[model samples]
Target: MKRKLCVAPSFNCDDDMEELNVAALSSRKESVAPLTAERDGTLFRHSLSYPLALVLRLRVLQIVCGISTLVMGSVAFIEERQKFNMGLGIPAGGFSILAAAVSIHTSRGWSLVTGGASVGAGAAGVLWIASGCLLIALIVQSCRTILDPSGLDNGDGEAIEDYRPSPRDLIVIACVQIVLAASTLFSAVVCARIDCTA
Candidate 1:
């Protein structure tokens, strides 16, 4: 007796396997994780609790400096009694006034611009001593504020809910102010010496 060879039919399931593979890939693509944290991960969100207070203080100081510069500019104009010098003083005063107004209006950009203009005018051979003194005061205040951080915090027993500038930051600001003051004073002395010899 001869035995017939048994054969099984081969099924075409390539399409089904392809579909399953596509589905698996799609699911994996949909399950991706975020690269960053949801909250407090943004750059601006870092240490923003006390920015308002700091801004306010800065604005006030800028206003004060601007006003002082304006006064000094006026004095310079009177002392010089020259048309060109008088015009310069008027513009400087106007800029200082504008800076004060901007600071009061809460426009930080304009205020900063005006503050810079006021300082520049002072540095350009007008009201040197007053500008130097103001800078010195600002530096001293910055140092005091930095060394005593408690003033920024609420004295209540509740949890501290605000950000106060660190002593280190204060020290840095102070150093910068001191440098500025010294430079202004030096410039003023040199100007005076030159004027005396001339």
Candidate 2:
């Protein structure tokens, strides 16, 4: 009598072994997990550079302009003898301080709205000859920055680079400054005439 060993087919054995291997692989993949946290951290670090630099520059510009306005407005208020001049100067100083604070708080970035308004108010508050001169200087410097043609980027062939003011904006600012200067001068003349009449 010949005894034969009962065994499953070789194909079934191979199939079972393949299924076990696949299950093991799936479990291993689940355990190994992806490095999403590390990848996201690196991505955030890389992306923050440009925006941070821009914010820093904007804050610096805002602070400088704001301080200038405050100082000029205060000087005018102190130096002017007339109540009207004092009134103008006080508001100018207050607006300057407010603009600076808003610029620092808001992340929308600096623009002519805040800086221009401060400068315009400060210019309007010009009561003394020294403040007038300073106002003129500030206007010229701001116009230069606004009109700088080289501010456009040539490297990447982009239409514009950084934040350069438009020609229209410069023209509007110039007009406002001119009007403020004229008004200030007129006020000075009127005051002088009143003194003469008195």
Candidate 3:
């Protein structure tokens, strides 16, 4: 009877060891899960300092510039009677806004995504460059019309009216527009080059 009791105790110890092994394995699995999630970029959020962090500070600057450009472009278009102002303002500003939003959304922890944000950024860069070119042309034309009204006159005695923005105002508007376009262009270049694997 004593031998039987000792043998039963030994069998119980084996069961205890097996349970401990299973518990250890489960604990290991639990620990590994979070690491995998973090590796997949789903577990943690990144700050603005990282080049491709989830919240890019540069995008905020871009949004501000975009809004200013949009407003300026609209005002110039209406006040200057320049169709090119609206053309430059609306699309370029809207594109900058849209691309920044997408970049903010698609960038993950310490990295950017594969397709959407990058492509949008590249397209935005091109649009900004285009806007800059258009602004340059508008400035040249306004300057020519202001400096030598007779050069563009067609014998109708069409005069540079008081309603048209003055040379100073035109220069201010064009300069602001060009600066915003250039800034947005720089931001786009930064965004487009963000590394996905980092």
Candidate 4:
């Protein structure tokens, strides 16, 4: 989507002109304070551009981490299923995949709700917090699943060696899950705090 950025025009400004412009801008914001509640489009109100880039970078990282989580979990789950006699029940890998999908959807759909036109704050808050908690749980589950030097995992440390899945994939999943959880939670907090309605 094309964001309508508020850009200050460049002009050869004398000291007096700059002071007048600053005063005018402050007065303008004071007038619109009731409508915006002092909330700016960017997450950081102090600066116009710095945190915007940081926010975007963090969001992109969150998306990448989610995708990697899905791919690694799927690969490990498939390989482990073939190697073991597990039932049709969903495992941590399955939950990881599910959470990855949720993370992707929430992160992508986040921009849509910034205008407060698509969804309400209450509903969005619930979804964001839910997804954050889900990812945190996944991190815990992934951490529990570790393998020794024998190249054998006990299926997220739940069962014995015979039931465990891929050990190598677990490492990748754990690392990616950690990154995903952190990035996602931070992004959600920013979303809840910012008011893009301006």
lDDT by residue (tens digit), candidate 1, 1-198: 999998987866998899999999987766653333345533343343323344445545544545554454444334333323222333433443454344333332233434433323323333434444454554454455445533344556443434433445445434543443344344335434433453
Q: Any runs in candidate 2 off by more than 4 Å, and if so which?
A: 1-46, 86-89, 108-198
Error of 4 at 155 (Å): 14
Residue pairs with backbone overlap in model 4: 145-156, 155-164
Per-prediction TM-score, please? 0.31, 0.29, 0.51, 0.43
Give the worst 10-residue stretch by lDDT in candidate 1.
80-89
Model 3, span 1-198: residue lDDT tens: 455443444457788999999999999999999977766433244333445532377878888888887888787676566646433666667767776766565554323233333335465445556644654554454455445433324578675564445546655666677677777767666665653334
lDDT of 2 by residue, 71-150 (tens): 54454333332223222433443443454344333322222223333333343233234444544554554355346423
For model 3 the TM-score comes to: 0.51
Number of backbone-clashing residue pairs for each candidate, in the order shown: 0, 0, 0, 2
Which candidate has the top score in lDDT?
3
Q: Candidate 1: misplaced stretches above 4 Å?
A: 1-126, 149-161
The TM-score that candidate 4 achieves is 0.43
Q: What is candidate 4's lDDT per residue for 167-192, written digit by digit as tens?
A: 67656645665565556556555643
lDDT of 3: 0.61
Q: Give the poorly placed runs of model 3, Cα more than 4 Å off.
A: 1-50, 53-55, 108-163
Cα lDDT listed for each candidate: 0.44, 0.43, 0.61, 0.50
TM-score of predicted structure 2? 0.29
* TM-score ranking, best first: 3, 4, 1, 2
